[model samples]
Target: MPGNYVVVVVLSSLAALVLLLPPLFAAVDDGMRSGGKCTNSCGNVGFEYPFGVEDGCYRGGGFNLTCNHTYQSPRLFLGDGSVQVLDISVPHGWALINNTGMVFNSTETRVVLNRTWDQLVGGPYSLSGSNKIALVGCNARVDLRARVKVKHGGRGGDDDTGSNLISSCTAVCPLDLEDMTPVFAIGSGGSSAACSGVGCCQADINLDIPSSYTIQIHNLQELGGSISPTDLVFISKEEFSYTNDMAFGNNIPQALPALLDWYISSDPSECTYESAPDCLSANSFCHAYDLGYKCHCSDGYQGNPYIRGGCHDIDECKSPQDYSCYGNCNNTPGSHICDCPRGYERNASTPNGCKDIDECGHRETYQCYGECINFPGGFDCLCYHGTDGDPRKEGGCLPVKHHLSARDLGLFIGLGVGSGTILLLIAVGAPFLSRKMKDRMRIAVEVARALTYLHSAATVPLIAKVSDFGASRYVPINQTEVTNAVQGTIGYLDPEYYYTGHLMDKSDVFSFGVLVIELLTRKRPTYRTDQGDSLVLHFASLLRQGQLVGILDPQVLTEGGGEVMEVALLAGMCTRMTGQDRPTMREVEMGLENLRVSKKLASHDTASSSLVSQMAEHRMIATGDMEESSIQYSMEK
Candidate 1:
């Protein structure tokens, strides 16, 4: 009757398990040792490998740069500004970056990329999902699109030609955006109708030549552009000022920028696999890279062949310590034995790694029991801050506490349950308790206005479910079938209140006129045929058999003939079986506010064979004890 779907699934599963469970936090990881280096601000930029700036420090592939001395102007970043490293080359396999853009050729049609349709596998360095992305001026329009593929040369082509995926498209650009330039493309480019909306679109990648790749640009506009841009034909002409909300034809912009590709090893034998074998030791060797490879400690070993007393010992005589070795120390075979001596500083000293100082450290002869205080490669137990158990490092003085109120036991259990539920409902208010507290305060104000209109329409997901009350009543039936029997639901009832079950407010306007004919026919008004008839024929028999386009909903006949004759004359006055020829929800809310102020009516797509031959079902001009032409002022005492 009034939505008792098991009390809305036991109170929405106890309010989603007491508001979606709590205690979250867990991410510590301590193997810590980062990489990728930087250094470059403007002009002739060259930052290299996996790109970077002072995390683990870089020096490798894809020249990972990141040296922005807080830009009094230095800027280089790649892994922080979501991509901006700007230029690096080993003869250009491609990594000349800068918030690189390649929303798989901004589409108008077939374009989808949730990471290239969820990449299956047998993979090996690939990136190019069809391209074209220029927006340099003129009211710019770049509605992005992507849904790429071409795995291992499909359409049958290369790898001697053996990697099935084959072609895909969507690369548009231009809505009078004045000749845009600043390059962008990934997969199937060049012709397929100017592949990424003129401005020279292109996509024809055939990767597997082992080189990392990371592509992901789409809908990015933090007040117009700069997520990724650096295709290095020696700085693709300084580009970066096309900001009309960073174009996806002006929409999908949250913040974006992406591009990644960094490979030097394709692995063949640089070592061994199936997990640990040739981790090269006898003075490190194996190196090959084109399929995959590794190793090199030869002339002087360094550390880690994946570890287990992992390699070490390369100490020539460059002495920053005994490991940096200054004088006579050349050990050879990976010579991991000679550096470090003469004023040490190569990571400064373990805990933070590498060190060697002895200014006798703020000495009182190394202050043996308390204050040695030295730094940048040295000692500091310092001591003196109300010493208690500390000469330097002891239990010291602990007790501090202060910051405690997580709302002090939720304000003492809401003022002790608001003084025990108002003194136990006024000590259980004397018997039958005023008609059970007036039907529990009219079902708690109609379940709090139907849970505040379903929590303010939970941000519109819309499948539609209904019926909270219809002026509440269960079964006191008998006033002559309330004038011929009306309750509801059975092919969303209301064919004139299923031939009159009377009760009015137009019986909830004939159940919202069979829910706007089940939201304009995603069909379900009824269908059975082979003599089971009534597949809801009749909106006067599909308006006199002009079959109101086989029962409406080609999206409600493309909206606007006065909004489909003001919602089919409010589903023909909530199914006129004459309940005073229906109306009133304040005359169907003032005839949908004068069909939304007659915004030039012309739009109803279905319902017409002269619309139910201009509607007519007449009979109950109005009387009493309910033959409901809307109960003539209710008086049958």
Candidate 2:
């Protein structure tokens, strides 16, 4: 029994060790438990967790730094020996690198720079979007090209090679010194101090640059020959604005500060709570970045995410200015609360939290017209109705102007009499006007339908060319030949055709539109008001001002509902300035047909619903009578 118990204890110990070994090994491998043994600095440059110069200090090779002490001061570099790392920012995962210089041709007329794709492959660095390509010359042309290999399935399986992508920009100098004066000022030695196309131009690189790319500059041939031979072209990380003249004197810096994006190389799918590498810090999480994963501290916490117990909660109340809490602030684990005192409210636009309520804003709460005074936590209204005086003073408002003046009394009487006269006229003439409008609308519809058939369905299609007679003549099908001269009446003729002497189907459509407007207003096209305004012009003006409702006949508005609005819109479209803007006869016919169909379906649905409701009422009434009779018969028996 003793031997069996010993064997059981040994097996249990082995199981426990097996269960605990993974996390222990992971913590050591990720440098979280390294206890600051790693070299954290190279010269003046400092390093954070996950980045170090020695083994067992960094998460992986991409995070490794090479400290070169060849110069007077030690310098840091990436895996690529040629690229010197200037600075590393852990919070933003960005690294500033001094890029290589551009190569100028022997003639200095052309400049070229090449970047290889292999530099970024399997590396933690990628090109960022904040880079710009600049060309400094009076007339310069720049061409950027890249050769990208396309993978068939996004994985590194089958691939298509040598797809060239190209982008180009051209900058031209002003015609003369006078033309350049507004953009750039001439300095003491006749030098311009602007880079905004007067002598230099810059364009942003909107798309991501492939690992392998080439930038080429060419001298643009202009009327005054090629630009200055001292021209230069290069890529920059910072945006360029017209500040100083750097184009002529070759003052542009050779190396520009360029940003490189960095991320962890670990796969997100393989990361787990028990096996996460360098991501075991409290209050931190892992997220996918580019082709791998990166670690981030949780919301309300900030610290080095790769170290154990690194993330800490932020006490927002301690920094009132940062959080814009002007009132009493209460601190929480990761946030704060700002509370306003009694009778005060929060100010949405100000950093100060509480403000006195503007009682005048709430008109119903304090109905005062003279004055509304606001205090620190409250407000007061100081005027009474039907009085005028200084509201801030006590008993300020007193009764005044209670009696009406002679002019006021006269105005009131005039308004009443005018209103009564207008109402009386409307009451007496409404029925007669209604009858006349119905007749006009019927005639207009018939005319429109006839025109639609003549233009689209007749054996010999008709075209309206006569001006005096309201008649149309037949023309051969699909015959769009222009007539010799315009032969239409002066008032109704399409202005375009009248001046150009060109006849088209749209000419007729224009005349029909005018007729529709005439019918709606119950007025002749030649009719004018006392102001001598033509009916057609007046109708167009009202429509343009969105006053169609005001100008529409009262009878038409009463009976037509939305249909009148649609017709009015159609009329406006047909009478557009250009004949080509008019709708074809077939389209006009279809529009009217659709409107008729919709109206018929709506009417049928309403009738069916009414019938059903009537039948239901009758059934209820009959059932009631039957029940009464049954009860009466039972009593008699």
Candidate 3:
């Protein structure tokens, strides 16, 4: 009862294991037999469909097997009792069977041993290519002859030869003939006991077996005066080793292990691209072998392809060693998708299927104009070397200037005075401006030095003629120049210059203010609303209402940020009705410079909480300078 219980448990466990396997491999087609439950095992070997012990259980007569109960233990044989089956590998389409060595006496010049196929004749079985013929004798040469099945390229099908010699080997005693002993017994040096042409030899079958073969042993030299020693030959698996019993041709095994190839169908062209009825399992296909056709599961599926729905999708995600996925793995019907995690990207070169994105390395997308420090998933674009501002924009990172300079004052003066001012002001103010105008004042100074030398060439105290003389009017720093008539571009003309009939430096400053409004709003000086109001008037009204951003260019709002608003406010001060009410060009430039410095300091504050606290007091002083010095238009004349 205990043994029965153990058997029940083992059977149940095996069933469960089969169920857990992919449908293609389930039970190895064990349950495919019809007419009541068929026996799946005989002795220790278990088999499946296409091979059975009873009628209606196997595919055909060729697949029928017999379980012999006459012995103490049950033994499985092919059809009747000729060959005993040891193991059957359904997936590999091979079977391990027992074979016997042939023994014959040779007195004449040659002796021949022949065996015919019986139980396995006309069946889907043949001695596999993995078997070799071995001969054990002295002073004899053995040769194997068989009818091998050869497939024809044309429609003629297979061509079976009448008799073809496949392989041959010779054996001889390496000692005196009178000794009448094997090579090992003679203690000959450099002679091995293995099947190496000394007393024993081996040869490959080298061709497909057709259930029958012949072995001819020719006695090269007779060892005795009459009958020679018995010669033994074995057609066994290629892995079989020769021993003393085989060398002396005695105590030979009744059954030596040999591999036999098997197939599902004898039809060579049954499984073509268009049709494969023999492969009944879903997700399975038929492939042709040298002799017949075999069924195999399609890619990503496994199991017995010879049975209906016996092939199931392989869970590739479960086997990481075989189907590797480094990130979030999603298994599908016949395949799987591996998606990298957030902030990561797929990399074919990496085994993990993903690699971290170097955000800093991609400057175009990340836009870091400063020191870029890369980390896992993300990166830091800190203002490098004490410079401060957003590193994510053009000219966003800027050098930290502690004090306003005369050049900075002059640049903004130009910005508020002419169309060229914006370029000149930005040259010294921020990197967002034109690179051509950077250090414009310095370049002008150099040109002036060169001109000074040019003027020295004039004999009459270097009388220098200034270009664009019409654009210049003599006016003292403290006084304005009176003109006979008001003449200027309509949109850029100074109102006070026409009323006072005078050309003052403030006239140029007024025109510069119009240019600033043009830059910020992306509107021409002549641009006007349906109400016939100029861009300057509309801009000034919006600035007074603290709605300066409403009319600002969208691009300026994005790139300029808070700096745009400060620039708009400065433009308003320059366009004031009274020339004296508007700050001087020098004061305007200084204010713009102060705004740049403030912006830089603000960026520095964001680096760390400790730094923010440390710079808080200085930031207030900088902010106070911007408010008091930059846009605080003085009314004093």
Candidate 4:
């Protein structure tokens, strides 16, 4: 009877336990469901709404994550089973995955690794910016090839073509350890940490992996007897450091983190609002990525953008640590504002968002030399220009020293003599400099105008292709003719005429451009250094590189003012690669004539102003003399 009672009690307890379990099971099941309300986590890694572990949990097939709990810890795998998922970010539209190790050949002389995107077809995943091909070892060479298969015809068609992109990188050890000593000194554990022309080298993988890509390493030569046969050449998402100990470690983890960019739409044409994926939430925008489309939350909002109503307004003012504000912080709907207090000001480089006004710092406004009293909004100066001493000290203003010793008087006389000499030199040299500048300008304008007239205005238009002023030929308009085979000066000869024996009006334009350059630079046309580089070529190169200032004559630049730039630009345009591109001689003449007229007008205006000033000064002196004479007459009477 006692045993029967115990059994009844156990049965009653089991029934109570069953009744309590249903609510708990329902709550757990709801948490695992997909969409915005679902729990988005696998083991220690956290994923967003677009990436989930179960069916109907993720946005699409490409974003699916398979949770394998058979191991000691749960592991999330990509749908293709080629990579293990590490982390996913909705804002960046990227996921971090683990890299696979390289496979060594039977002879150990070569290693190969591959990344395939076959399972990602018609999906939104692609290898993005975070990956790079790394080659590590002495005298290691890497051959990287990216191959993608494209369907040529319509659906179900057998037409297909493979496009391949090939590139290579080589890394070699230095001839001497001393050459690498500096690099080793700054590196951690005396390892060559940088991938720049050392035992390790890296090249960026810019192309997306659509079908497959391969990285093969060959020509692995040993450096010294200590070189390990386990040299690694692998694709890395994160940068790797090369150390001597890594070569000796058993089963070293070659897996590295790689970045994958994801999109919402499989077909690019369907990226429009009417055909967009249902996962894209409100306040989100779509962008083209690789062959598909990606969704991003608008600015000022941050959350799971692929979920309905997931993105929320960011309260910037509430998080003062994230937003910068010095005085008053005001938060708007999508942005924030920083304003200065009453006594402060705002500047481009204002520290901590606002700068306090220092009224005494501005000598022109406060005008204080001895003492300055500062208030909340304004300040007052105790002493001004005549006073001498520190501003903050009491009774600081004192009479300036006026008495002079014999040495001070001698110094004053020496300074006066020096100043007078400077004034005399300026007064004498200024006119000479001015005259020299005007003469150069006038000569340049006259030469250009003469060339223009010969090419266009004369009864028989002449092409002055020859360097000598005496040599010339007549050519009428609306005619294409070949000139007699004659060689002119080396640098001045037109390249087209020299090659094809054809001469045109543009041939003279080329010569004129060379002449202008020579005049500006004050150098001979055929001038060459020991390197056999001619001045014409040098000048052209300088102009092309925007270093015309370096080759310009110092005197011309100082005196020509803005006209120098105009002349340089005109010369550059005239020296075109082909005759058709060069400006006509008539155009050149008009440019020079305009520059000359402007210069003459400016000089005339300056002279007139100087004459007016002299006349005014003389009239004031004459009026004072008359007043003095009147006063003298009154005294005599």
All candidates: TM-score = 0.19, 0.44, 0.49, 0.44
Candidate 1 TM-score to native: 0.19
Give the C-alpha lDDT of model 1: 0.34
Q: What is the C-alpha local distance difference test score of each model?
A: 0.34, 0.54, 0.56, 0.55
In the range 1-637, model 4's lDDT, one tens digit per residue, is 0000000000011111122111111121223333546546768888865666555555554566667777688887665344577788878777776766534333333333333333334446666645676665555577666566566677787746564655567766544566532121124544545666565666777766642444455655432323333445656576755564333343445466777776665556656763365435677777665567767777878776666676677787787567665556687766777677765678312446556578768755555554444445565555433345555455666655533332332233223322212221222222122233445555455555556666656655666563433335556676644476755666666676666777777777777777677667777666775555566666655654557787787767767787776676566556555677566766666666666677465443442343334333423453342233222112111
Model 4 stretches with alpha carbons more than 4 Å out: 1-37, 80-82, 106-119, 148-167, 173-198, 220-228, 245-251, 273-275, 319-324, 342-374, 377-637
- For model 3, how does the per-residue alpha-carbon lDDT over 1-637 read when each residue is reduced to its tens digit? 0000000000011111221211121133335452247777888988877677665567763566779988888998765555678899766788887664333343345434343333334457666777787666666676676666567677967776566687788877566588753453233433335777766778777676655555555656533433244556666776446554444445545556777888777676887983486677778777887778888888888766766766788887787457766676677887777677766897532376678899877888877776666666777666544367887777877787632333443322322333333333333443222212213223222222322332232222111111111344433333434454666566666777656666665665676666567667767667777766677777765665567677876556656766665566667666767677565544554454455567456442222333223223323443343243222222210
Residue 625 displacement (Å), model 4: 72
Worst 10 residues of 4 by lDDT: 1-10
Clashing residue pairs found in predicted model 4: 370-391
Query: Top model by TM-score, which number?
Result: 3
lDDT of 3: 0.56
Best by lDDT: 3
Between 1 and 3, whose lDDT is larger? 3
